[model samples]
Target: MPELPEVETTRRGIEPHVTGAKVREVIVKRHDLRQPISPTLSTIEGRKILSVARRSKYLLFGIDDGSSVMIHLGMSGSLRVIAPGEAWKKHDHVGITLSNGKQLRFHDPRRFGLALHFTLPPEEHPLLKGLGPEPLEETFGVKYLRSACSTRKAAIKLVIMDAKVVVGVGNIYASESLFRAGILPQTAANTLTLPRLKRLTSAIKEVLADSIEQGGTTLRDFLKSDGEPGYFRQKLFVYERKGEPCLKCGTPIRHAVMGQRSTYWCPKCQR
Candidate 1:
């Protein structure tokens, strides 16, 4: 699945190409995505794209007609910019042709992504209303995270992964951030001291910023809008290292299952 950084990278990659470009047409090859692509999605055909923004892992396209288009790149989805009438790939599920003679295509082999159109304020959307703060934003500092963890007895890793606690800290980032903060993934959330929570808060922001800088970690299904694979995978210290030697301590990295997701850490480095 495309995590926060991957989605942010996509937003940055496509923003310049699509911004201010009038939509010449909307084509839907498969409406049966995670959320059915609404037939009315074509209403933006004649509207100009004003801006592109990201919240959590969703891409928000601001249209001139007071409506917005939101896309979620569910497990295996990706967006690409190509020439108009470009040869379509096997999973090209949707396309938006622009006045600039470019076509924005969405591809998802697993059919788990979504493209929806709405006129309401973006934050009011049901899928977005309950989300916690963006980790990179100033609102998600140590005090905020400390409060959220104060009452939770779940494993620290699981607590941080909760979207209601903090948006965009997916399984990969949760593991990576925990490793950076020197915290065991199995530690109880409420048992963490203020200093530990402070370290954790900073670690989350740092890991995410680093990934976005590297265009996000490409672990199979993700690709930038230019179709380039993200290079962050090379910087990973844990996550998928499994039994590989820890880069910092030479201790064999440990792997386990937490919240049904693969978890990795350096046994000696992360206490």
Candidate 2:
């Protein structure tokens, strides 16, 4: 699935082309996404897209009529901008033709993505309501993390991965952040002190910022809106490097399954 950085990268890449451009048409090749394409989705046609923003892992396309379109690139989904009559690929499920003469295509092989139109403010939408602060926002600082982790008995990795505690700390980034903070993934969340939590928070912010700067981690299903792979994967310290020598210490990286996600860490470097 595309995480925060990946979604943010898409938002940045497409904003310049889509914002201020009127929607010429809305095409739904299929209505069965993770969330059914809203029957009212066609209402967006002829409306200008005022802005494009990302919240957590969802992209928000702000329309002139106070309505918004929210999209989620699920396990195996991507968005591409191409010519109006370009040949559609097998899984191209949705397309929005713009007055700029370009079409935005959504491709999802697993059909697990979302394309929903909501008249309400995006924060009030069921999918977005109750989501925790964005990991890179000021609202998600050390103090907020400390409070969220105060009562949890779950492993530190699991606690941070909780969308209720902080958004966009997905499996890969969580592992990378913990490794950078010198914290073990299995450490109890509530057992950590304030100073340690502070370091962990900083590491999380740093890791996410670095990934976004690099255009996000190049996972199997993620790609920039321009169809280029992100280069952050080459900079990973511990993620997916099980049994490999640690970059900091000579110890071999260790791997385990926690919260049903593969986790990697350096036994000697990460306490």
Candidate 3:
């Protein structure tokens, strides 16, 4: 799945090529993804692209006609920039051919990705309205996280992974953050002291920032817009490293299910 950093990397990668370029045409191959592709996006033809941006796992291309085109690289999707002369891959599901002869292509073998056209402010868009604060934004301070998790009975790992608590702390990041903070995955949220919470908050931000720095961890079904595989997987401390030695302690990293997601943590190092 494309997490926040992967989505952000995609936004940065394609913006340079697509921005200021006029949309010459759009080709929709198979519209049904996680949701039905809106039929009106064909109107995006001829509009100048103003900007390309990302929020959470969603990407948006601002067009001159007061409308924007949105994309979500659901579990098994990838977007890439391909030259007009380049041959399309078998999984390529959609294409936005620019006036410059370059194209933005979406590839999804599983058809879980989505392409939609909507005119409402992104904030009010049904898909975006209720999202939590961005972890990398300055507004999401430790105090903000502390407040969000106050008195919760949920496991600390699950609490932090909740989109309503904070966006972008996905399965990989949640495990890495808790491992770094020395907080057990099953620790009750309300049982954490302020000091422990502070450490956990910092760990969350650090792990997320580090992942973004490495261009995001690409386990599978994810690729940067330029098609480069993210290198963060090499730096992982606990994610998918079941039974592997913990970097900080010799004990093997443990894996368990939390919220139905595989979670990794150092049993001895954490709590």
Each prediction's RMSD over C-alphas, in Å, is 0.9, 0.8, 1.2
Candidate 2 C-alpha lDDT tens digits along 132-250 = 99988899988888888888989999999999889999999999999999999999999998988999999999999999999999999888999999888999999999899999987
TM-score result, candidate 3:
0.96
Clashing pairs in 2: none
Over 1-271, each residue of candidate 1 has an lDDT whose tens digit, in order, gives 8999999999999999999999999999888999899788999999999999998989999999989999999999999999976898889999999999999999999999999999999999998999999999999999999899999999999999999999999998999999999999999999999999999999999999999999999869999999999998898899889889999999999999987899998889887
Worst 10 residues of 2 by lDDT: 141-150
TM-score of 2: 0.98
Higher lDDT: candidate 1 or 3? 1
Candidate 2 lDDT (Cα, 0 to 1): 0.92
What residue runs in model 2 are displaced by over 4 Å at the alpha carbon?
none
- TM-score per prediction, in order, is 0.98, 0.98, 0.96
Badly placed stretches (over 4 Å) of model 3 are none
Better of 1 and 2 by lDDT: 1
- Pick by TM-score: 1 or 3, better one: 1
Best by lDDT: 1
